[model samples]
Target: MTLKQDTTSITTSISNPTLLAKVDQLRDLNIGQHVPLPQLVVVGDQSSGKSSLLESLSGVPFPKDQNLCTRHATQITSRRDKDECVHVRIIPGPRASEDHKKQVEAFQTKVSSASEFRDKFVDILKKANEKMGLRTDLSSGHGGAIFSEDVLKIEVHGPREDYLTIIDVPGIFRTTVHGTTKDDMVMVKNLVKRYIRDDRTIILAVLPSNVDIATQEILELAEEYDKNGKRTLGVLTKPDLVMEPTMRASVCDLVMGQKRPLTLGYFLVQNRSSDDGVKTVSELDQGLRIQPWSDLPKDRVGILALKEQLQSLLLDITRREFPKLVQDVASQIRQCTVELNKLGPSRQDEREQRSFLSRMAGIFQDRARAGLAADYNAHSSFNQTDLRLITHVVNLTDVFNADFQRLAHSRHFSSLEESQPLESPEPSDAGDRSESQSGLSVDTLRVLLEESGVDKISPKEQMELAEILVLPKDIPMPNEGFTDWIKEVYLQFRGLELGTFNPNLLSVAFTEQSRKWGDMTRIYMSRIIVTVHRFIAATLRSICPEEPTRIQLWAEILEGLLDCYRKAMAQADMLIQVQQRKQPYTLNRQFAADLSKSRGHRITALLRPKAKEDRRFAEPQYMVNLDDIAEAAEGKHNTELLQEEIHDILHAYYNLALDRYIDNIFQLAVDHSLLHGPDSPLKVFTQDWVLNLEARQLEDIAGETISEKKRRSRLSKKITDLHNALKILKSRDSY
Candidate 1:
């Protein structure tokens, strides 16, 4: 409600708060056991609908309404912490760590041979994901291509900060620099090799719907990337490219292979097809389709396969792997200390680089306190959970403080002496400088450090520098939504039920079942959350949610988070089992993936035939494939049926809420609760009732929309005056 009064910091706007704040929060949540916002790294060549798929997955209008969602290996980490924005960063440098040299070498090679510097930047994350050994090979450019090792980092905000990290690798092979695409299995292998320090991360490699499993990368990435070498689920992006359900199913089978209990599932996405604007949460959910192979069109069969694979994986991760990830990433961080010592120095500096958790404490406390205040609720069960949340924050700081501290200040110590002279060797050995066991010479390290603006530091000190910050790594997003403590305030003060669970409450648990309701609530809640979030975010930090079209921007962001919720809730059977066994009956767990249906696109007679000029594109490419689009649209109602459904769903929700509203208002009135007070449930309800009663006021506002008679008269007069002015100007010029 309060706008920013502070103007000292120029970057602080009504969008993002601060970059450091976001990182600090990410670190705290991560340390506090919420780490690794798993990302679905969608990789492909330029214009291969990589952006389109991301847009669909992220629910952003993308190409139609915004610029490239990615400039590098950009990741869309879900807003898992709280009021978070869909942030994108062009990787400006590699990560700073003891192993930073390896990252630098990989990026340098990508930069030297690449057609675009940005692709090299993307290579860093792709390589990092590859190292983690996940199926991340489904890059978009020049068909599928393999991503050489690169550094990748992703953070998300929702109910928590710690989640999976899905990386969007560079669309591949557009140039000779990017190599080739591998199967999911290979992608997984590479991802594990590079980024997945533990079991916490999963790679969701995106493939074109037009392409099939026969594409070596599609099949191979799964083969190589799958857990225990099992196949991966496929995400058949752009279902509009294919229409036949039979073909879609076949593709699903072909990509899924012969895995027991099926290793994959597909999902149909049309992020680009969001023709009408979406304002409410229900609309966001009506768009995601996580159904069976038989139910999907030929193009989405791949997506369906991917969805199934992911669903099963999600269940496995939540059940079997989650606990282990906590242990593993921690172990890996410890191992990083060992790696730092083994690779470079005998001891960590433990000075300049404080533990991530330690450096972030102040930021965390400020955010936590603020978040608690904003999200305070006397009746909710979680009201008592705040102390626990704060405790979790402190506990996390403790768990990783030692490990992070050791790693953070590694630079204050040196891996090797700056002046350590290289032993002169034979010509044959001289050619292998990079392959040398000791790495580049101290002089070389010092020179490199100096070039990077560290002349005051020694080569040993440079080596001590964090590998995550070495080269031009991805730039952090503008601090619009980043905060140390996230206070998520669901817009509906009185919780609304999308299904069995209170939509507000159901949002906390990340399951595949509650996703639908979660989707609906997210959008509906966003209308209020984003407004307040922007106001506070600006006051707090840098970057504001400054855009000409606020609704479209919101729709774009809400759409993406909505996708994540649905994806998380896609596995209903397991979620239901877990909830019934553990706690309450939640919406997603109760009703996700209950139907195997489609938006059912149908071509109408009035629909113009596809000519050389595809109406979708303003201009016709000489090599336009009219049959492809026409065949794609075949029986599909390529119409606004989905939007219509969303409209119905929203009004239904409003109608349902209206009943409760009326009853509550009547109850308060009977109790004689209305009084002169600033804060009271009865008073608030009375005010709301009055606002609702102002139908006449709404009419007055609506009446101004067209007012053609007066508007036209004013415009006509202005035009005459303008004509006269032009004449006078012309005369003056002549004189």
Candidate 2:
């Protein structure tokens, strides 16, 4: 089945305006420097009429020779204009910028005459090869040579030109030639791959009809980059070379998508060979009208059809990609702006330096205040909850208090009555007799006897007989063994006595338990300090305009602030340690209340009746002596009450201390060290102090290097181009 021809429609399609003009505007702004742009990348094997096809489409006679035609990528951009002119230039690869600059100075020019354009074009390419260090000497014995990935750009403007831009890359080769090495073959293939790999690119895979499509490396490479073949268009160049009927039929099958179909399909074009001389568009058109061509579909052959198809494809792609391209440019602009801000300003003198430092100081001060106030919104770096240093301190305080309270109630500090046996069944009669005989003066024995009777006597009775009866031995007399034993038992019950306060065993337990507070708080404080340090560094870099001054001042400020932070943290830790030492202060009224409550609960639990299952009789009654049980329960209840009081006091004090420690951290570590002006390390940035720095030091600190200047220039250019590209896109009604 032969495809029908539409010669008039094809001609009209070629003349229609395309979105290539918009694409050219994007290229002109060099948006590709930051992001890939929509393009048509032409790729094929060596001597596949790639140059001829490009020359025909562009109407520019590109140099054709084994070594001169295509070494690096040559971008040919043509547009319709009233004036007829040609402009040529080179966009150097990253590593070859200097050579490119030199070449531009020597070879960049404009031409109006076709002959002059051709002659000057070849000269520029040869010079570009030299500048790019691409060796032209094939005769050199050493066949290995490197090729450059640089591009030579040519632009043409004329009334007859279509608004289009296409990239013609070095043709792929199987083996090394004079100036080209096996590496060069790889380099060219890689270059082609880079272009085709871009989703926005429309790949034109050129191949001569004489060569087997299987042997064409570019077709395989294109397939590799565009596996679905959605954007790949096969251009079977040198269609005139297929003389045999069988071969023609095969070519027809390829074009008609019968063999190895591409999504975009194929077009057969009769491109002018080297011996065909410089043929005009009219002559090429006239030639295609001949015998075999007349029998073929008009839309499937000739440059007009190829141009129309390319324009249509490029426009479709551009429309699809334009919005994204705008968004990308805007994103890049923001990124570059951020980077430039980080690099800081190029301060020319002391005044600017002082102003810059002052501004940075102000920003730092504001952020520090925000941190202290726990205002997360004021600074993006601070998290809403934990990252705010004050909030973190508060959280830590809660944890510390909870831990302290837990320790106070732990079994380690439980009352001796609950934790140990009540007594050793009062000493044996033999032991008691031995003690009584061993050593007690009459008076001491009498006093002990009186103390033993005290519980039997009422408090009123003891007060009434105070003068007649000798006072019980509050102080033990010498040679009194019984009195000594009484004192020892009293001391054991008291745990350890410090002054008037009998510091509960809970204190000792807590000291050991909370020892990690110092180290933990230290680690926590260190993180806060580091966070503030990084913030200061980043803030200084962004706000300060002078690079040299920013570096020097940042170092000095960081050192001083960290030193102040260290001192403040030490002070806060000292408070924590002091609180730790005085732990378990159980002097609060709440302690008494809690202790009473606990005692009541314990007594109630003891008095409560047992379950019916535990009893053998249907009616359960007092099997044991109620009086003896009540007396024992009373003693145990008193012991538990005392222990509970002590633990309650300790917990109350721990809570108070934790609260005080948190306040101290905020007051000392955060407020004084970071937020306070005169005492803060950040005070060094005061306008007077910065302005008073020696001129020589300022110069040394703020000096800009050549590389820095170059970087700034490049960034500035990129930002401007991005902004321009964005403007262009925004102005378009379709966008």
Candidate 3:
């Protein structure tokens, strides 16, 4: 075949025989060690003619004696070629040591001619057994492995070759026999399962016609892996040994697919006999031309038909599985390439190490900026909640603001309860509101006057006096219940003035109101630090996938970021001390407006009594009168009014200060000092930072160790092999 192709169709399609050869080529590349490849795997119980079937198909002489059995798996690859050749070698198992692999790989030999391979092949099998540590002398005291996972690979080329690959494993055995130990039985079954479990493998279940077909273990296992018998092919051997009429009928039933049906049904074949030693297809067919066999289909009873069937089956599976195999190989190449890129170029010296650090620092800065800015499109990780620094910080500040607003106050403000006045029906709007109101009626009032044995008043006046007597008590002052406490605080900070008090009372009250700020701010600052910590950790992992290097960077960079957070927290505490411990002060205009607004509401409630029909609580009209003002100032209620004014002033200042402090904590403390700008925590990893590091520190951070060097070498070799495998799939071939 010639390897040349157009790029488009090469990736998407391949011809049947070429695809089959592609699988063989990949197997030769040892890609099967990394991924499953499509092939036929022959399996059966011991003495079930597994080796005999392989011999008939490959035209190889397999030893089938009463005392000897296959100890390890043998992989035979046959390809059609003009020149005849046979090459044999050993492929070590995964558990084999490096020294053992080198030892086994040297057992390669090329046969001069396929026609003259019988004598050399037997000697080669013996040498292969020795290499795998399988005992050659069953009678000798030299002990060896009962079963080996290592494979003996035989590649053959001849004019009559079919594009096929077959693996013949040691047959399953339920009990120990001959010189084999109990462990041998378990190892053999396990080896069979490892091959058959792969979905790409077609199971060749070899059954002897002389034994009960229902008693075979290999068919049961095939059913386990291939529930619908899709990939299982049944081969019936030793038909000549079944002499009885019933046994003959049973073999005929299986061959006709009347019992234990398989998707790729049974084939009956006769091996070269021990008596006459017949070795030709005609002689083998003559042995099967008996009562039941003669009546069976002509195509299902000979070695020639079995060979054609296997070749067709192998071709069909290759066509079905080649596309997926190519995809798997390509996908593995991409994954390995990404991992190799992550490891990056070697850092052999101080200059290279420093360069590596500088590059990584740049990546860190970019990702950190993107995360802090909430620019999720920059990296997929920015969309993740843990790495969303801006979103988390904003949400934390919102919660902090809400908690401060709700819990930072020393006393709760009472909402004014408006009185619902009952309106006596007006002349035109009669019963509009009175019908909805429930109050004393005129008839009940008159009955009460009569029962008191007093003179009866006029009906209208009686109703009016009854409504006036039933009017709810004047709406009480909002903080009248807290007056005692207010008086105590006022007296403690009293000055020489009669009604005015020292401003120290307002400051002390504010200090108590904001007592929880310190503890709450500490917790809030701690949560912000944690949020930044998680974001930085995620960013580092994204930029540096290698574990050792990431760990070193984390150890170097995290402490400096934490120190920044500590400084930011110290700044926040200083602001709290300025607001709480010092005399309260603010230039905000909202304080004056809020104080005026509160006093106006209180004065309106005090000046106007509850009106009978004033349900809207309308503002009372203000009239400037010197006499009325003098009377109010000298009245008995003046002290209470003064107390209310002081309370209003303190409350207004508290509202103004609350908003300012929350903003300062978020901006000055968290956003400015810790998260944003050139000297912020996000700027901790930079090219400048790397340049300042000493040579030893740079080496410690980025230098490769011995194990790391070995890993890099191993990955480089694996990536090379995978790339070659992809080229094999994409390269065009002409048969």
Candidate 4:
């Protein structure tokens, strides 16, 4: 293949002598094996003349039998050579065995004439079916289905052949046939879709002109994969069969780009019917030049026109996709290499197994350390928020302590002194006392009688008695004593009413407020455990890359580790619960001492004697001595002191309990569960434990399954193929 080289641009034309050669070079590179390559993919419903179109283009007689022809993908590469020859081979699918692939490719038959080529191709198909174990008959209903999605590659070189490569896939069917099921139909559609889905592929959606265009499944399928119709070309076959005038008009509309116009437009070609027998390209062309066939546009009515259109389309697509194709292959090579490296070197023997185990242990140990330390940045999988497991537990504990305090100081346990009523002012006059308001003395009665003239008294006697018994007109109302006011204030300050002083009340309130702490503790601990478990499982999968080992680690080993961690956390929670139930205790004595000092000062202020000048005239002139007042004052003071002491004690114990509970949770739940040596979850991956595993245990952990080996082999082969493809593309200096 040669090209009219230009550094700045690529101008492709079907008239260019070397254009087809360039495309043939691409096909020879097997670029399709690694990445999507530019090509023509023929798609149509059953018996839509797809095979005839291909045969007309390549000048080869493809099998015409419906059952045997085009059962699998047929890739034909045609090139011009002085010596005419045809070669056939099979490229097995990824699942096919090496022996089967060789056997299929080994069958070779060359033909010089179109008739010989037709017979040889049919024989090749029959031999391939038998060798590949594909069942062609379904009447007996005892074997596997007939068709496969593998490709049958044919390379033809002749002096008159145009250099081109085209793929022919199985015709799409709507329902099952004798040998086909619903699954077979689905398989055929998927196979066709896989090819047409590639952006690099130019789809030739063939339909018989007699059939409704809407009824052809290939057109719908093509539209789905090529919505813009940019890469799709409609090919209407059997146009000679459409005898009706309306059908001819519709065909003309489709061909003239009027009805459901595609970007590349449509081509109408008439192929020889099945009963017409084999004919040469010269005969077909001469026949097309006669009568009504010659009336249509010469460019749209012949196989020669269709071939030239396809050649131009293929060249244009190849030029457009060439640069992108190179980049895609290079990128795939890098990605596949990285993935293969990650799978690590194969472990086949004892020493290799030991090395693999050591590597896994190291990975597990490092991840475990990072998780326990809450160092989320150590791994890409963890984020800052996920690393706050311990901090969350600590915050939960703080909330619990605050709730306990709130309950302890609630209104139900408030001191009575804080709620006591204040003392009311004593009555200032006799009228102010309800009991003394109606009392009448003899002097009042005598005064009334004298005013009424009931009796007469001497002036001297009246004066002397008035001086002795009459009160001063300006006398001050009787005032309350300082001692009485002090006693009233003391009574109000006394703590605790009747039922509030019960110790059981404090216990009940504490219990009710702190009940959620246990549940919260368990939940927080469980969260931490789950986080660690996930971290370890993810780490194991990354390190080992084996499903069996991952399953075993989680089900057998890691589960036990989680159970142990759970039990430890539960025990720590139990300890906390027990401590909470104990009567609140504390070693702090400063609060009690401060309360005692405050009480002493209040007592001194109450008992101080009143000064002589400070005494009121209506109050007693001498010191008032009331034993009951002193006793009551002393009793109220004692009660206040006792209540203050109890409050101080409980407050101190609440703080101490919080400190101890926090310590216990950190030790048992966080540290013992994950960070503890020897008993820690990380211990499962220690070198000593892994190295000491028995043969059966080691096999269970690191052994490979037959399917896994095959998968790896396939991956390795694909990577190698990609590398080889990249080398070939890169070898072209212009690229």
TM-score of each: 0.29, 0.58, 0.63, 0.57
Residues 506-602, candidate 4, lDDT per residue (tens digit)? 4543454345456545544544454444445556765666677567645546545655565656665677677657665445575466445545544
Candidate 3 differs from the real structure by a C-alpha RMSD in angstroms, to one decimal, of: 16.2
Q: Write the per-residue lDDT of candidate 3 for residues 621-660, one digit (tens) a residue.
A: 3444455544544445656666777777877888898889
User: How does candidate 3 fare on TM-score?
Assistant: 0.63
Every model: Cα RMSD to truth? 49.9, 18.1, 16.2, 22.4
- Regions of candidate 4 where Cα sits further than 4 Å from its true position: 1-35, 94-119, 136-144, 173-183, 210-215, 239-250, 274-279, 330-353, 366-551, 554-684, 702-717, 733-735
Every candidate's lDDT: 0.33, 0.63, 0.73, 0.62
lDDT per residue (tens digit) for residues 194-269 in model 2: 8789889999999898788888888888888899999999998887777887887778788778999999988888
Clashing pairs in 2: 138-178, 345-545, 548-701, 584-650, 586-649
Q: Order the numbered candidates by TM-score, best leading.
A: 3, 2, 4, 1
Sort by lDDT, top down from the best: 3, 2, 4, 1
Q: Alpha-carbon error at 466 in model 2, in Å?
A: 62
* Comparing 2 and 3 on lDDT, the stronger one: 3
List clashing residue pairs in candidate 4: 416-496
Q: Give per-residue lDDT, candidate 4, residue 538.
A: 59
Clashing pairs in 3: none
Evaluate residue 212 in candidate 1 and report its C-alpha lDDT on the 0 to 100 scale: 55
